[model samples]
Target: MHPLPQLESYAIRTFEIDCNQQLTIPALVRLMQETAMQQVLELNISVWDLEQYSLAWVLIRKRIEIERLPMLGEKISIHSYPTGADRVFTYRDFRVYDEAGQQIATAATTWLLMNLQTRQMSRIPAELLARFSGYFPPVEMALPYALDSLPPMEQAFTSRNYVVGWYDLDFLKHLNNVHFVKWMLEALPEETLAKQQIRRMDLLFLAEGNLHDRIDAQFQQIDEATYLHQLVRQEDKKVLATGRTIWV
Candidate 1:
């Protein structure tokens, strides 16, 4: 068997940066995910292949820690590989560095295999497990805790409704997970974004939102820089996603 490929390089585009000239959280999340997907596809188990097996990769939890967001016009090299699996959950680690070789961020994410037909969790296949059997580096940074479970705080904060736009849909025909992070950050107070930078962020996707779904977003300020947010469908009040952000 060929050794699994382990790293990829990406350019930091001007549109990917924020007003401060640093990479935005949504763009960073997209990069990490794209790198991982590319690595997996190169290993022969492409998304189309998984679909043929009636399987799909569903992201359950993700956490990222940033020492410093890379600036625009820089190149980033990302190193990533599957760490291991636990029953139905497969874990992966990503480490990013600037062109100068300075560490920028580290992230670890958990994914669950889903039975595409039934829409339920599925067990790991033997062949899939064997692919990651040998020699991979351990996660160097501390794995972050899962996002906290939060109660509805509607009375404390005003909620705003947003229409899922055509641009928000991905190949999956649903709102891309990174856009949930984007919406959560956009819902924050302007002063908060101006003064604080995200040190860590955790997100849990509970349900999928389709085009035309009305999403109600509500946020609560835990403190000056920490916040908890929730997004849900307005029709049935079904929860869509929850996120917790820590800023410094």
Candidate 2:
């Protein structure tokens, strides 16, 4: 269920810059999400209307590979398209560009339809999924383990957590991937954070998590800043997604 009409573009704002003077990774992602909202609104599927049915679309998982960060005062254009929609799942794709038209990042994301009251997975309404047709390239929802999986975590990587609250949820309802990464990055040390830059990142998903789930992000130092990151259940230590971000 891809929507085909136009590519959504965004303007940069002052507050969005990170300490390194580039747009914060989270803000870049927020812009990509903003573009999708514009597409949906152009299709006449207002956020207010979706709320009427006690339904919301939640980004289940996303992967972003950035080439270079954009600095302050630069304008951006983001093209967003639906990959396709499947029962209980919808795929979204994005390409971000800088003022000079060079590509900055490419991200593909998956979303799931959820019932507000029960907070359970539900099938995408046929009409809702069809709204995206003609707009997205042929895309498919990824199944677990097929993307890739990692081995079990070490014992040191257990019983940590960051709570789910109003601010943690993005426009998409699920926890933002950057927030997950931020927690993973910050949990280490400033020395590690300052010296190492992420060279490669691979993340795999196993389940959806939300409010009050008692989640903890775990890590093992490969060397310097490189690490194996795991998001786990606090009680059982069930693996949610295993990730690796290597530092250069």
Candidate 3:
């Protein structure tokens, strides 16, 4: 395979920033997602490549840590690579840097191979594992690749309702993961969004949300700087995803 930790640079654009002129979480996710797609495509192991095997990648959980959010007009570089794989999951990591080359953010993500027909998790194919082996350095994140459950709502401090739009669905016909982050943030108090910067976030995607589903996004403050969030489908109250975020 090509050299590890492929790099891609982007100039933060007008549309990618929030009203405060800082890069938004969803935009950051899109940048990282594009960088990842480029890396897998270069390795001939992209979702299209796996489609021939009746499989596709599904992201299960992710954790992001930010030293600072890049501002509008800033140039940032994302360095990403596959970290390793186990029976059930393949791991990936990303480091984001600014024009001055200072690290601003890091993310660790867990992905599973899904059987296209059954929509069930699948074991990593030996050949596929072999393709990634030795190309990446030893894994740096902790093992078991799990996220902690968000504390029970106990009465959400704030809530908002949204109907999934056609544009929110991904190739799987399910809501794209980044929108979950967007909805969660939307449910937060306006004061928090205006005054604080996110220092870290952890998300666990529990279920798929289809188009036009009514979603209730709820947020609860656990402490001064930490908060818990949940997205539930209004029809059956099925939790589509949960998240925890810490702000500075």
Candidate 4:
């Protein structure tokens, strides 16, 4: 079997940080993309050489758990690899650590290849899967997480609404997870925003709503305890996604 690929490294870009002085979720997602690309390169089948192929990797669903987000000035080391493949999804794993090697977060995201022109998922090419299977690494204590549905929608919280926009889509052409967090965070009262420091958070994506899709964002909490937020499609009342944040 091939050895696990070397960990990928990147410096935090200023534009990737939010006003909170920490790496935003969207930026973290980019880092995941960067490392995964490196993993693809190790197999000698990266997209850079895909002029002959009409298919592309697409992000389907992701479940991330962050212990503490990296500060603006800190650098992070991300170790990632394709863990395994299911019927239609190839699972990729990630381990993020600070400069001191203290693990900050662990996550797993699933991806599927899509025909660029057809825009539909394609089967996992056997050769491609075989090459990646050998590079699987040892599972860490908190390996890539398997996301579960939000415990309950509990309407006990305050809620606000916002519409989706074109800019929110990623390479997969749907609402990126970070954009969901942004809209939900915005629902917090200005006073709660004054001294907020998120210790950890989780995002659970459900149905994919389109541009101009009005979403109802709800939240309720006070005095530094964990806060819960949920995003739902306003018209159908369908839950779009859910998020949780622990702050001080």
TM-score, every prediction: 0.90, 0.75, 0.93, 0.74
lDDT of 1 by residue, 120-200 (tens): 999989887676645344445335434455445544354577899999987667898888888888888887887788898
Backbone clash numbers for all candidates listed = 0, 7, 0, 0
What would the per-residue lDDT of candidate 4 be over residues 43-118, giving only the tens digit for each residue?
A: 8657554435677776555666678889877989998877777667777778899999998987767677766677
Model 2 superposed RMSD (Cα): 4.3
For candidate 2, the 10 contiguous residues with the lowest summed lDDT are 138-147
Better of 3 and 4 by TM-score: 3
Cα distance off (Å), candidate 3, residue 32: 0.7
130 Cα displacement, candidate 3 (Å) = 1.8
Name model 2 segments beyond 4 Å from true. Answer: 1-14, 138-146, 155-166, 169-178, 199-215, 223-225, 232-242
Quote model 4's TM-score. Answer: 0.74
The segments of candidate 1 whose C-alpha lies over 4 angstroms from its true place after superposition are 1-5, 135-156
Worst lDDT 10-window in candidate 4: 141-150
The pairs that clash in candidate 1 are none
**Candidate 3 on 1-248: residue-level lDDT in tens?**
44388799999999999999999999999899999999889888888899889999988888999999999999999998887777988888888999999999998898999999998999998888887766767544423344465566676754799999999998778899889999999999889999999999999888899999999999888998999999999899899888899998
The regions of model 3 sitting more than 4 angstroms off are 1-3, 140-150
